[model samples]
Target chain A: MRGHFNYLRPDCVTECLDMLDQYGNETAILAGGTDVMISLRTGVKKPRIILDISRLPETRQVEPYGETVRVGSTLTYSELIDHPVIRQEFPALCAAMGCVGSLQIRNVGTLGGNIANSSPAADSIPPMMLRDAEIIIQKKGSSRIQKLEKLIVGAYSNTLEPNELITGIILTKIKKGYRESYQRIGRRKSLSIARINAAILGRLNDSGVIEDARISVGSVAPSPMRMTNVESHLKGRKPELKTILEASRMIAQEIIDLVGVRHSTEYKQPAIAGLALKCLEDVFLDSSVN
Target chain B: MNLEIDFCLNGSEIRLSIKPWETALDVLRNQSGLTGVKEGCGIGECGACTIIIDGKAVNSCLILAAQLDGRKVETVEGLEVDGKMHFIQQAFLDKGAVQCGFCTPGMLMSAKALLDKVENPSTDKIVEAMTGNLCRCAGYVQILEAVREATCMKAPLNKDDVTNS
Candidate 1:
């Protein structure tokens, strides 16, 4: 707001990275700017230069890249919902995207911005984590990819460097037997940020045995976390009502250990358990299965 | 340094030198003289400042003017045709949805964008489209009814078309 910094509407990724390197912390990559504008206005983040990367062509593409699906940082939720690959391959992400405000907010909000901002309540995190998504970050000349769980270390915190710009996200495809679900608890039906959310993806064998399981919890901890212990316990076990209910309890226990029994714990711990059980129930007890 | 943004405003092309801090609402209400776009929260929460960007609706306060480099922005003023009331406007007036009128423009624009994409949208689609724009009047029931009436009208309503009804 103070300095007359050049507004670089870079048409390409290289130009944007160049600006980021030259400016470092003094520069900020402007995606949807839904969060950036709030930061800028409140002086929480006063970047000397606003790198308008929202217009970059590379950040708008969301197509299949071989076995892995790549989502551009600039692709809004509306675009994501329309993308055939996203709708088919990552239904949980699509469901989470649906819970992100209204159609208008989804039209402008970007997946890259969502992951980069690392908001604990970010609706997309749990779903993307369930997919075991990897984030692609690029600087002036170097590029690095990290699992999203590692990228988002804490609330409103991430491993991204000042000169780094998140270009795309890579989500690995699960097998045909894989079933997933995403659920959230909010105050109202619409336009509400989630209080607690859960995403569950489990691979079941022909014999109705859980081959592998991954569950991600959001808005309960400093960051969205994967339930490793519960997942391990449910491995190769038939995820029936009994197993799912017990696994749900284990998930609640793990979350309690991490987030501690805060004031909301009395409400949240039980709420998250019910959500996890429901998600597992849908996937494990699908009528489509032969 | 100066930045030039070229976009269609109220169905006309515009080119202006905008600051880095300027918002779409700032450009619409200030430079374009379409003051119908009001800034309620300045941060995208309140629907009082909603506008159509490209083909989708968004909070004008949340979008920077520099972001509208090659997009079409339609404001509430664009709702009228030849100084006549648009169908959505007539529906609002008919339903008595206009209370303080502060939220009327945004609500109308949001409704127009929704019905434009969906000729006969379901209740869910209508609710989804207008969800981002908030009306403090808590007259949401009337607003919802007005939007439904506009959607059912099917055609644009004229000024003379109002009194005959």
Candidate 2:
């Protein structure tokens, strides 16, 4: 709380990019300030210049191009949850965002901030990864786009340059036949970090056989990762109770292969299986049952 | 760095010179003489510093004072009109929802935000909205009843009337 920093609010993306270029390593870009404020207060990070991009008009929009949607970096969880397009087209993403911090946190925590922070336990990343999300990064005079999986290089780290800003996120639209579900287990329901979370999207053919599947899990590895091995195992298979149970076990095995045995693995191993089963059931079986 | 910020607090517009690091909770309690905005947790975990900023309930502790520039804020001090307490405040008193009184302001703010959006929120909705504000005194049962009671009262002429006084 006894730190000295200069705050700058830019009206447009151009102005913000200019400031980022000028300040470079000395500046910190703030979206919602939920994470940045905590880092600043705990002495985890110290930046002389605080560039406030929460109010920039350029990063506050949600637009659709062809079959993909581009979400502004400053869009808060509340805004995204209430968006009709997101709620209709991406129920799994909406559900994942809804599980973010409490209502107060959702009102102020931005999707961009969540991505930029790159916490291995971030609830939003797994859902976005399932949808094949990409982020648009901009520096002073140029810009580039990177896949979400590639952008986040490690825990609490990303490929973003010191002078670069994440302007927005682009998500591929879910196909009409696809059904998706997000499941998370935390210490408690609200206001707690996820111990493990899963996002599953699958398509079932008319004959009741799984045609395609995408799975992503978080908080079990160095970063939130796509479970391609599990996805491949489930694809071209019928989504029966036995298949789901096997897939659940595969999810546990995948996490073990990624992070090996640890203090919490004994608990997390079964918990991951249970969560994966729940997510797959919700997307493929529960709706038909109920 | 010091900067001048103009914001509306408790239905009145005011300008002040504040540091970039000063939180809105600090400015409201120390500079603006509004001590009702308590700081149970300096971090955003606790909602003790909840305030209405542009019709949304937010933790003032997480917001920078400079971010309030050109914005409107409403703290617990704004919950009275013509020396009479708002209906939400009265319900809290009648329902015995104020224990130790530290979490009252924040609880009231969160309730007001909920009632403003949903005139007759279900019990589940009420619980969901109040999840952020915590009371270690274990007064949640009565707090839940108070919010439910406030919903049955006559709707305010203007939603801001409960907080813009």
Candidate 3:
């Protein structure tokens, strides 16, 4: 708030693209300013040109497009939670959004900003990974779609070019009978970052056989990594207490191997296992109960 | 350097020249002459400067005045009518939701925005909406009651009587 900068408001996406194309990284895209302002205050990040692109109407919509649902980058988490299509189709995202800073943070924290900021514990990432979110990056006359996971390279790091702005997040509608659940171990219920978070999306055959599975986790390693080994173990396995426990251990071990055991691992490894087990329980084991 | 922005303030359309360094809280308290929007933490962590922009409740301290251009902004000072306080304000008074009253404005605005869209909100929704607006005294019980009371009164009136009938 104390820093001096030039403010730019572009009415159209094209204009924003032009501004970014022209000014490059000197201009920071201002969405809700929830994260950016905090970063500026702490001297963690600095931008001389603060471009306010939140007014672009086209990037503020939530709609179902063909087989993909397109969400405007500037759309706030609160709006996304209340969005009917998002709530019904991708409730995992809603659950993830619900974990973000309280209701007030949800109102101001933009989905685009969340992805662009690329924080390790970004509440929206794990669920977005469950949805296999595609980030739409655009410039004046160029556009490309990149997987959200790939765009995110490391903690507080992303592949986004300073000159390109994120336009939308496109998620393919999956028809496989997948059950989804999210669990996060945070300090408190509100405004707490996840010490470790897990999201599971999979479907069981009518015969109670695991047909396909996808597991994503956050706040464990550098960025939220997909537990593909765990997924592979469950893809053709039968749904049972033993298999679920094994899969949970597999995820916990995989996390350990990747990031190694940190001081928190004593609690986090078991916590991660428990969380993974709970997700599997909710989706595969406890279907009839709910 | 100054940038001109047009945004609705307290339900009225207004335009002002804003320095890029100024936050919406700065504008609301200084240029706009509405001090109801208080600034507590100056960071997004606290919601003392909460306001309803368009339809969502946001921390005004985190919002740059430049970002509010051409948007509808509602503040706590705007919660009163020609003579009577808004239903949420009245409910807070009746329910004793205010402790020090510093956090009351943000709480009321957050509650108003939530109840405006959802006439009948559950206890969880009330808690969810008010989570960003921190009350040091932890007056959440009374604040929750105030929002519920407003919802209870506003539910029967239907949409016709919502805006000060």
TM-score of each: 0.94, 0.97, 0.94
User: What range of 10 consecutive residues in model 3 chain A has the weakest lDDT sum?
Assistant: A281-290
True contacts kept of 1: 0.58
Which segments of model 2 are wrong by more than 4 Å? A287-290, B155-165
Model 2 lDDT per residue over A159-220, tens place: 99999999999998889778899999998888889989999998888888888889999998
Docking model 1 quality class: medium
Residue A290 lDDT in model 3? 37
Q: What is the C-alpha lDDT of each candidate?
A: 0.85, 0.90, 0.86
lDDT for each residue of candidate 2 in B1-165, tens digit (9 for 90 to 100): 579999999899999999888889999999999999999997877799999888888888889898999998899999999999999999999999999999999999999988878878999989988888999999999999999989987365555677888
lDDT per residue (tens digit) for residues A193-225 in model 1: 898899998888777788888989998888998
Q: Which prediction has more favorable DockQ, 1 or 2?
A: 2
Which predicted model would earn the best lDDT? 2
Instruction: Give per-residue lDDT, candidate 3, residue A201.
Output: 86
Task: Quote the positional error of residue A94 for candidate 2 in Å.
Answer: 1.0
Q: Write out fnat for all predictions, comma-separated.
A: 0.58, 0.68, 0.86
